[model samples]
Target: MTRSTITGTAPPEAGATDPGRTTAAVPRTGRLTPWLVLALVVLAGSAVLALTIGPANITAAEVLGSTRYHVLTWLAEHGLGFLDPGENPLSRIRDAIVWEGRAPRLFTAAAVGAGLALSGAVMQAITRNPLADPYLLGVSSGAALGAVAVLLLGFTLALPLAAFIGALAALGATLALAGIGGRLTPSRTILAGIAVAQGASALVSFAIVASAQGDSYREIINWLLGSVAGASWSSVAIAVGALVLIGTVLLASARTLDAFTFGDTAAASLGVHVTRTRWLLLTITALLVGAMVAVSGSIGFIGLVVPHVVRLLLGARHARLLPVAALVGAVFLLWADTGARTFFAPSEVPVGILTAAIGAPVFAWLLLRTRGQS
Candidate 1:
């Protein structure tokens, strides 16, 4: 299939404002702008709303007040003490609830969600396969294996570092296997990743079954299921740092991704250096995924679902799809995580469980819709 066949828009002329934007498809920018604005507004509102939730009855006013006071204090500590915003605006308990309890987790969720969704969109484009996602390369399973090893062995090592190392190792193995016979095609990459994932998952299961004990067992289980309840200021730093650093590169490659939509041959013809671009993008994506899974263990479906939903509404233009999908994914997971913590009152379920439950039915609907189109 060609670019026109898949996107229903012809290739661009050399001097087009965006090489990915064809004149025939340019009109949707007007429609896409409002959705982008709405997604930004909703994401901001959701972040504030998430802070006010939980067993505590903190109001939005308290959330905002605590946020302002802390922001000023942070600035003062960084050599701007002249700009002090007075004494603590709220009681220490209330400030702790906003700053220590919910704020970091909220930022972590948004960062991880945005990273995963952006990676998924890029993966799908590079592979020219709608089923590709952040985990399609075995990063999650590898991270889980590493985390389980740390927990079961009673190691004092940092869990995120171990998980990140495992994810990189898995990516290396998958790429090596995919390149064994000849060129690294998407089909070969996918199959190699599946094999690696299964191997890592088996090891993780064995470690849990054979060595897990008491509290460690529960800790392993929670990490595998994904929860941001343990998120701290460090978690926010790690997650947001990775998102800003790698996610920017992915976003800047939007036109390249658009070139990739048709296939390697089409992309190469359009001056995209298909082979090099594919490998580089895959490696970059793996790094981003590794970082996210290290912080929030193997959260699923936001990547798979959000990009497609955005494309359905905003067209397949990568420039629009990537950012909008990021914002929407952040909002989606924020609410989902909030519900996971609050829905059962005293008992806190894993956020991954909630995501899978919601994502499964939505995925089924998307699948059926695709089949019907065929």
Candidate 2:
């Protein structure tokens, strides 16, 4: 293939007949803004509605009230008593359920969703691989290994720390392997990641089979399957912090990602430092994914499916694609987790299972659609 074909762009002399050939074409920002606003509104409404869901009998009004009550209480405690809304309206149980249980879990879900989706979008663009997700680098398996090891060792408190460390280690290893023979290319990176993932999976299986017992076994299973059922304020803080800080960097690289879709040589010709940019973006994505997986284990599909769905609606330009994808992803996972919380009633299903169940069919549909379009 010529450079034009490889880069998905046609030379002027070749004729501009294939309008859809170029991947870097920017769409009108005005057309995309409404989608962004609608996604934001939907995400906010979904979060509140999700809070009101579950076995607990709570309403949207009550959820809002609880949120207001907490804000006021915090303000009062911080010596801004004048801003306090007097009197606690809800009973202790309701407050605890909303504040202590559901609120953190819901926020964590949203944050993780946003982060994963952002990571997946960047990954797909950077590698020019549509099937890539946050876990394509073996980060998720490594995290599971660390978390599982801790659970078996009776160090459940250190699960998040261990998981994050393991994810970083896996990232390091994958990069090292990918760079060993020559310049790190997308295909090499992917192969190395698969190798690391398989090795980590093997270790995790052995550890679980040999050591896990009783509640530890169940805990290991739950975590591996991914759940925010035990999410606390701390989980919310980590997930949201990672999303905001790292996510900003990723979003800022929108134009860089757009250039990437045009192939390395094309991007280089456009004055992008392809190797440096790829390394930087990949490392940043791993850190964000690590923080997310540490808190929520390996929640799948939000990363894989959200971007494709958003791209179908908004097109492939990264500027329009990134933020809107985050919002839609937040809403998607928020509801998936809500279903996980309520669908089985008293026995909560793992959110990961729900995402996979939902993601598989959606992904297949996306593949068929893409094929038809092509």
Candidate 3:
């Protein structure tokens, strides 16, 4: 398909005059400012619903109360005790709704959603291909090897750690494959991604088949299907750490990614060191995906769908697209998770299954739209 050339708007120069504040040091009103605000509201509402609307039927009020109490207690314990709230019924309910059950799951879902969406956006830019996603490009499979190995061997404690290593390894293999004949081109890079994904898939299958015994086989399948069930405080900690670390890194590199959206030659001419930037971006994305996949298994489509939605609304500027995409992604996953937890009641479906189900029709529509445009 022939893509529409993004034109008219000049890329915002870093450190330029702030158009919004009417000062030289101020930042301009990004073109998608209003849409971004709307996305934020959607995200907030979705998060609230995810936290409160389980089969257990916790209300939004209960969810908020619990979260607030926990935060205040944490603040007090950390020497910010002045922020503590007094005794209240809401606080008690909040304790039940937020701490024991929904908080960790909600956070994990948000983190995984944001991470996948962010990584997908970066990968699409890196490859100059709209079809790119962390999962589709083999980054998730790389992470999955570590996770799958964990399921196969019944490994505890170091599952996330192993997944991180596996992801880096898979990415390294993809890069090595791409650079086989010297320079890394888009076609070569995508081909390498395909090869790595297939290889990872083979290993995962072998692991599953080898452990086809009574216990591990079902565990393997469940793990592959992806779930946010059984999340705990430790998992939340890992996910939060991953989000803060990788989100910061990627946000810092927003300009570089934006440069990449214009294609490699243009990015290079605009002072982006294409090779180094791509390498670093890939590594960062792999790490983010690994951490998220480790916590949430392999929830799909939020990455692929959210960024495109953001692009449609925000016109493909990475600066605007990045945060907005993250928010929209978090919203999508939050609601999807709520559905997964509740739709079948006692029998929970994997969040990944729910996302794929939703994404299929969206994917079809997008393909049709692209074809018509072409």
lDDT scores for all predictions? 0.85, 0.87, 0.75
Residues 156-231, model 2: lDDT tens digits: 5678899999899999999999999788788999999999999999999999999988998998899999888888
lDDT of 3 by residue, 265-292 (tens): 8999999988888877777787788788
Q: Where does model 1 exceed 4 Å of error?
A: 1-33, 81-84
Instruction: Flag the better candidate by lDDT, 2 or 3.
Output: 2
lDDT of 1 by residue, 138-229 (tens): 99999998888788976667998889988999999999999997888888989999999999999999999999989989988999998887
Better of 1 and 3 by TM-score: 1
lDDT of 1: 0.85
lDDT of 3 at 77: 82
Best by lDDT: 2
Q: Which stretches of candidate 3 lie over 4 Å from their true place?
A: 1-31, 88-94, 154-157
TM-score of each: 0.91, 0.91, 0.86
TM-score-based ranking? 2, 1, 3
Q: What lDDT does candidate 1 reach at residue 339?
A: 89
